[model samples]
Target: MISSIIRTMITEFNNDVDKLSNDLTAQSRNHVITPREANR
Candidate 1:
């Protein structure tokens, strides 16, 4: 049960990260962020 709970948490974290990356990509399209800037 503990392992299952951990897995669920990790999955949710991954989904959130993907979503944030997509949002960042959209914002970058409108604005300008150097590759190095985004990398940092």
Candidate 2:
């Protein structure tokens, strides 16, 4: 039972990390694009 609980916690943590990285990537991409758009 303890091992199963630990496994579940790890899975959730990995998911949160994945989501955070995805958000950061998207924001960075937008920042890169926005500057060029403003200059144009």
- TM-score leader: 1
| Residue range 1-40, candidate 2, lDDT tens digits | 9999999999999999889766666766778445444434
lDDT of 1 by residue, 1-40 (tens): 9999999999999999989877777767767765455555
Q: Return the TM-score for candidate 1, rounded to 2 decimals.
A: 0.78
Report the number of the highest-lDDT candidate: 1
In each prediction, how many residue pairs overlap at the backbone (N, C-alpha, C within less than 3 A)?
A: 0, 0
The local lDDT score (0 to 100) that residue 8 gets in candidate 1 is 100
After superposing candidate 2 on the true structure, give the runs of residues whose Cα lies further than 4 Å from its correct spot: 32-40
Looking at candidate 2, what is the lDDT of residue 17? Answer: 86
What's every prediction's RMSD, in angstroms? 1.6, 7.6
Q: Give the residue spans of candidate 1 off by over 4 A.
A: 32-35
The whole-model lDDT of each prediction reads 0.80, 0.75
